[model samples]
Target: MPDDARDLDAEVRYAASPDVAWVEGPDRVALVDLRDPASATPQLCPEPAASLWRAVAEGPKGESQLVALANDVVGEQAEALVAAFLEALAGAGLVVAT
Candidate 1:
């Protein structure tokens, strides 16, 4: 793993809150949050976010493992990107960090 994959926090898992629902389209996946009826943040994730979510779909995963997986799929800079995506997912209550 690259140095950028270091200093990661706890493991995270895909956690779908009741407030949000997952929607899968022909070409992409999306999340619909019921918290705000009018405003919807696009859940159409790119690259490692989609892959990372798939990784943790079965269970929780450490940041390092996730980064490694993303790195394998998306190549360079995947660690930083996956970390950031995980943070956003956690913040949105779509994932749980433990």
Candidate 2:
């Protein structure tokens, strides 16, 4: 976890790269990033994570900007929420921060 919000670059974009595919079923929206069809498991982004994915798809944005955009969905904890969301996505190798 980053001690400072600025430690997280706001210019990073969520790269739903070509290697990943988006699937929207009646009950869910998931991103399938399979490193190997026979080995790596696909990751599922539910609710806010799914929402965040959609937002990042618009373009590269900073943490503050993401929080601001997600304010209605998250309320006062927007900053923390956005940061955590980005962290999780990055950790999953679903997004790249640069």
Maximum-TM-score candidate: 2
Query: What is the overall TM-score of model 1 with all chains considered together?
Result: 0.64
TM-scores, one per candidate: 0.64, 0.70
Write the residue-wise lDDT of candidate 2 on 57-94 in tens digits.
65666666678777877688778778798777778777
Candidate 1: residue 28 lDDT (0-100): 53
Please count the clashing residue pairs in each candidate, in the order shown.
0, 1
Residues forming the 10-long window of minimal summed lDDT in candidate 2: 9-18
Clashing residue pairs, backbone N/CA/C < 3 A, model 2: 10-62
Residue-level lDDT for 97 in candidate 2: 61
lDDT of 1 by residue, 1-98 (tens): 65544444333434445566666655456767777868977577554477776666546677777878878877898888777977787777777654
